[model samples]
Target chain A: MSEPRNVKNLKDRINRIEDILASVAAGDMDARIETEIEDDLSGIEAAIDLLIDDLTDELRQREKMQKELETKLKEIQEQQRTIVQQQEDLLELSSPVSKVWDNILILPVIGTLDSQRTQIMMENLLQKIVDTGCTISILDITGVPTVDTQVANHLLKTVTSARLLGAECIISGISPAIAQTIVHLGIDLSTIRTKATLQDAMIYAMKQNKRSDEMKVLSRNALSDEKED
Target chain B: MLELAPDRNFELLGEYAIETEYDIVMARQTVRQFAKKAGMGIVDQTRITTAVSELFRNMYNYAGGGKVLIERGDVESHDALIITCIDHGPGIENLELAMSDGYTSGMGMGYGLPGTKRLVDRFEIQSKINEGTTVRIMKWK
Candidate 1:
C-alpha cells in the first residue's frame, strides 16, 4: 500500500521549513519561504520571515547608534585637545620674559601664582638667564595678589635655581600685604634679595652692573700689568 | 570658639565664602580694604589681612571650604576689625597642642596657628571632633 498524497505533501512542506530555518540561522535573512498557499504551513512560513525582518531592523538600528556614539566620543576628544592647547597658550602668555635692559631680564608676574605657573616661570627664567647670561633678573610681583607659604616656597625655589645659574634674582614690588603676610608666616626669605618697588630693583641692578664692570676693568688692568712685568 | 564680646556692638562689613585658592586671595584683598576703611593703619591693616589670609589657608587646607565673616566694632575707644572663620570639616583634636609653638602634626615649623595668633590682638578657636572648627581673630587700631 502506498502512502497518502496529502501526508506526502505535508512532509515536503515541513522539510522546506527546516531548510529555511537553517539558512536563516546561517546569517541568510533573504532565505524566506514566500508561500502563497492558505494553510497552517503557510502561516508558520510567514511568521519566520517576520521574525527575521524584526531582527534585521533591530541590528541596523544598533549599528547606527554605535556609529553616532563613536562620532560623539571623537568630538569630545578633539575638544579636550583644543582646550589643552589653549591652556598652554595662556600659560605662555601669562609669564612673559623680556630683556628690559642690558644684563637685566624682567619677568612681571601679573596674576595669581600656582605650582604649574611657578614651574613654567622657573623654566623660562632659567633658560633666558642661560641664553642671555644676564647677571641681574628682576621678578616683579606687583600684580600678584598674594604670596602664601606655598607660593613663597615656589618663589624661593625659583630664586635658588636662578642663583645656581650664576644670576641674582631680585624679587621686587613686594606689596604691603604680601610683605606682612610673608613675615607673619615665619618664612625665611632673608636669603633672597627683595625690593619695595621695580624702580628700586632697577637701580640696584644698575649699580650691580656698574660695580661688576669696574671690577672687570680692574682685573684686566692687573692682568696687563702682570704681562708687562 | 572665641567669640565677639556681645557688649561691644559690631557692624557687619562683608562676608566671603572661601572654597578655592582664588577665593582666599580675594578675601584677603577685600578684608584689607575693609580694615583700611575702618581706620586701621598700614601696619595694622597688613597684620589683619595676613591673619585672615592664614586662617583662610588653614580652612582651605584642612576643612576643604569655609566662610569668613568680617565685622567692625569699637574697643577701648578704638576701631577693632574682627574676623571669624567657620568650617564644616574634621575638627582639631587638640587645641592646646595646636597652639603650641613648633608643635605641629610634624609637617613643618608648626607655626600655622601659633604664628597667626601672634599677628592678631585676640585669638580664639573652637572645635569638635567630628563636627567642625571655628576661629575668631581680632585686630585693634
Candidate 2:
C-alpha cells in the first residue's frame, strides 16, 4: 500500500507523479510519494495512475528478462549435443575401410592419434578379423604423432583381444617419440610384434605369407610325387 | 521438448586416468548416439552434442569430476533435448567474465563458452561462488 502524500493542488500532484515516473524510467524504483494528498485534484489522481502504470511496466520488463534467460538455457543444451554427435561421426568416418587379403587383414591408420579414435580402431579391426576368419592382422600407425599410456594401453588391448579371437595383431610404425613415451611408461610390447614402419610390418607379413604358400606347394608336390610312385 | 522413453542404449562405463583427457571424446559419442537414435534433425543433433561436450570437458578438467544427464522431454508443442551437467568443485566467481570467451581456467583451448553458444539453440549456466555449478542445456529440433 502506498502512503498518502501531502499535496497543495491537483496540478502539483500531477507534476510529482511525472517526476516519480521519470525517476522510475531511469531505473530508480525507490522514488515514491509519501506526503498526504488533498481532495479535488483529479491531477493528483492522474499522478497516482501514472505511478501504477510505471510499476506495471517494470514488472513486464522483469518478466521479459526471465524469458530471455530460459531461451538462453535451451540454446546451450542444444549446442552440447551437437558436439557429441560430431565426435561420433568423426570416429565412424575415421575408420571405415574394410578389406581382407588372403588370411591376413590390414588396417592402416593415418592421423594424429587420440585415445577415442584408437578405441574405435581397435574395436573395428578386431571385429572384422574375427568375422573374416583372418589369422593375422596388421595395424600401421606410422602417420600417428606419438603414443601415450592411454593409446599404448589401447594398442595392448587390441593385441590381447586378437589373441582371444585366435588371430595375431602386428603393430607397425613406432615413431621415436612414441617409443620414448612407451619406454618412459614402462609398457612391455615384447609379446606383440612391433616393426620399424608399416612397410617393414608388411614385408614381415609377406614373408610369413610366402612361407605358408611354399609349405602348401611342397605338401601338394609331395602328395603328387607319392601318387606317381 | 520431446518425450522419450528411457532407453539406456549406448552405455559407457569405465575408470580412467586422472590426467587423461580422452573421456571428453567418449562423452561426445554417447550424446551423439542418443540424439541420432531419438531421430533428431542434423542441426539440432549437432548443436546439442557440441554444447554437451563443452560442459562435460569442463567437469572432467576444471571440476575434477562430474556426470552428465541427458533426456528428451516435450513442453507444449516443442521438442527439446535436455542435458544437465553437475559438478561439486570450485564454482565460478565472476560468471560474466567466465561466460565470455578467452577466460581460460587453464583447461583446453579457451573456446568453451563462446563456441558452445554458437552450437546450441538455447543455453543456461548457473554457478555459485563456492558451492559448485549446474548447467542445463536444451536444443529444439
Candidate 3:
C-alpha cells in the first residue's frame, strides 16, 4: 500500500510539469510549476523556470532595441527633410533681384558663379523684367571673387537674352585683379557693356533711363500735336 | 621624368576630374591653395593656377572629361609641384602644330598649348592619334 501511493504522487508531479510546459509553450510567460516537495525532479523544475525567466528578459530586450531602431530611422528621415528645406531656402536666398530705381533692377552676385546658379539668376532676372516691364538691369559683381571665361560668356548670353526682352544689362564691378586677369586670359570684353564700378554703372543706367523717358514724352507730344492739327 | 623618383617622397596633393566649366574654376581655386601651401609667391601661384585652368578647359572641351593629378616632390633641393593631365580624347595628330603659337583648332578663344608651356619650369606632352594625350607640367618652389 505504501509503494502504490508513492508512485501515484510521482505521476501527479510529472503531469503538473507537463501542463506548465504546455502553457509556457503557448506564450503564457507566467506559467510556472509549484513544487512544494523537494525531490530529484526539483532541480530540473528550477532550471526550467530559470530558462523561461531568461527567455522573457531576452525578448523584452529585443523589443526595446527594435523600438529604438524605429525611432532612429524616423530621426534620419526628419533630418533629410530639414536638409532639403534648407537647400530650397538657400536657392532662394543665393540669388535675389531687386528694383533699386525706376526701370532699373540690380542683381548683386555675392559669391562664385556656377551654371545652376546662373540659370536660376537668368530665370529670376527675366521674370522680373516681364513682371515690372523694366528697361534697364544692372548685374553687380562687386562681391564676385572670380570671373572665368565661361562665366563671362554666360553673362554675355544673359545680356543678349535681356536685350531680346527689351532690357539692357550692364555688368559692373570689375576689380583691378579681375581686369588684369581678363587681359591676361585674352578674352574679348568689348562686345559687352562692362563698368569698373557699380556706381559708374548705376549712373550710366540712370542717364540712359532719363533719355528714353524724354524720347517717350517727345513722341507723345508730337502725336497730340498732330491730332490737334 | 628622371629627376622625380620615388625616393623624393612625392605626396599626392589632389586628384580631380575635369568634366565641366565649373570644375575648371574649382580646380583653379584648389591649385592656388596648394601653391600657397608649398610656399610659392602670389604671382607664381597665379601663374601655375592659370596654367592648370587652361589644361582643365582643354580636357573638358575636347575629351568631354579627363583626369588631373597634382603631386608635390623635392627636386634638386627645391620643392616642386607636378600636374599631370590625362585625356582619352581624339589625340592631336600633329603635336608640333598644336604647340605652335596661336594655333587654335576649333574655337578662336583658347590660349593655345604653347602658352601653357611658357608658364611652367618644365613641360612635357605626349599624344597618339587614336589613343590619348598626356601633359605634364612642373613648377619649382
Candidate 4:
C-alpha cells in the first residue's frame, strides 16, 4: 500500500510539471512551476524559473537600449538643424545691402566669397534695386581675401541679373592677386565696369546720380515752359 | 598611383551634397570643424574650407549636383584629413589644360582646380569625358 502511495505522489508531480510547461510555451512569461514538494522534480522546476528570469532581464535591457538610441538620434537631428539655421543667419549678416545714396546701393562684401554668400548678395542687391529703384549698385570687395573661378562667375551672374532689372552693377576693390587670378582664368569682365577702390566706385555712382537728377529737372522745366506758352 | 593604406583605419566624418550654394556653406563649416579636430591651425582650417567650397561649387555648377566625402585616417604615419569630391558632369577633355592656371570652360575665372591643388598637401584627380570627375585632396597634421 505504501509503495502505491509513493507512485501516486510522483505521478501528481509529473502532471503539475507538464501543465506549467504548457502555460510557459503559450507565451506566458510569468508562469512558473509552483511546488512545495521537495522531490526529484524540484531541481527542474527551479532551473526553468531561473531561465525565464534571465530572459525577462535581457528583454528589459534591450528595450532600455532602444529607447536610449532613439533619444540620441533625435538629439543629433536637432543639432544638425540648428547648425543649418546658424549658417543661414551668418550668410545674411555677412552680405548686407544698404542704400548709401538716393540712386546708389552699396553692398560691402567682407571676408571670403563663397557661392552661397554670393547668391545672397545678389538677391539682396536685386531686392534693394526694386525697392528703392536704384539705378547703380556698387559691390565693394575690399575685405575679400581672394576670388576663385566660381566666385568670379557668381559675380558675373549677379552683375547680369542686376542689369536685367535695369541697374548698372559696378564691382570695386580688385586686389592685385584677385586681378591676376581673373586674368589668368581668362575671364572677360570688359563689359562690366570695375573700380580700383570703393571711393572711386562711389564717386562714379554719385556722378551718374547727379546727371540723372539734372535730366529730370531739365525735363520738368521744359514741360512747365510749354504749359506757359 | 596614390592608394589608401590597407592597414590604416578610415573613419567617415561626414558627407554633404553639392546641390545649392547653402550646401556649399554647410560643407565649409563641417570641414572647418573636422580640420579643427585634426589639430590644424586657423589658417590651415580656412584653407581647407576654402578648397572644399571651391570644389563643391564646381560640382554644383558643372555637374548640377554631386557629393563630398570627409574622412579621417592615418596615412603614411601622419594623421590626415581626406576630402573626396565626386561629380557626374562633363569630364575634363584635357587633363593637363584643366589643371593649368588660366584655362576655363567659359563659366568662371578658371582658377578653381589649380588653386585647390595649391591649398592641400596631396591632390589627385580621375576623370573620363562625358562620364564624371573625382578629386581627392588630403591635408596632414
- Steric clash pairs (candidate 1): none
Tens digit of per-residue lDDT, candidate 3, span A1-229: 2232222377777887788889988989898775655679878878888988998888889999999999999999999999989977877788899999999999999877766788998999999999999989999988876665556666888899999999989999987766665666666778889899999999999999899999999999999999999
> Can you list the residue pairs that collide in candidate 4?
none
Model 1 spans with C-alpha error above 4 angstroms: A1-90, A175-185, A221-229, B1-11, B74-78, B93-97, B100-110
Candidate 1 TM-score, true structure as reference: 0.65
lDDT of 4 by residue, B1-141 (tens): 223334346798888888886677677778888998889976677667767777887888888879888999888887899998888899778989988886788666677888788778888888888888888889897
lDDT of 3 at A29: 83
Model 1, CA-based lDDT: 0.84
lDDT string, candidate 1, A1-229, tens digits? 4443233377777887788789978878777766666687778878987988898788789999999999999999999999999988989889988998889999999877866788999999999999998989999999976565667777888999999999999999998766876777687889999999999999999999999999999999999999999
- Where is the poorest 10-residue window by lDDT in model 1 chain B? B1-10
Query: Would candidate 1 be rated incorrect, acceptable, medium or high by CAPRI criteria?
Result: acceptable
Q: For each model in turn, which proportion of the native inter-chain contacts is also found?
A: 0.31, 0.00, 0.04, 0.23
| Candidate 3 overall lDDT versus native | 0.81
- Higher-DockQ candidate of 3 and 4: 4
lDDT of 1 by residue, B1-141 (tens): 433345478888888899997798898989989877878777777677767877898888888989888888876776788898999888899999988766766333466788789889888888888778989888887
Which ranking of candidates, highest TM-score first? 3, 1, 4, 2
Kindly list the per-residue Cα lDDT of model 4 for residues A84-179, writing each as its tens digit.
Answer: 999889989988899987889999999777656777888888999999998999999888754655667778899999999999999999876566
Best by TM-score: 3
- Model 4 segments beyond 4 Å from truth? A1-8, A11-15, A18-22, A71-100, A108-124, A140-146, A172-191, A194-204, A214-229, B1-91, B96-141
Q: DockQ: which is higher, 1 or 4? A: 1
Evaluate residue B65 in candidate 1 and report its C-alpha lDDT on the 0 to 100 scale. Answer: 87
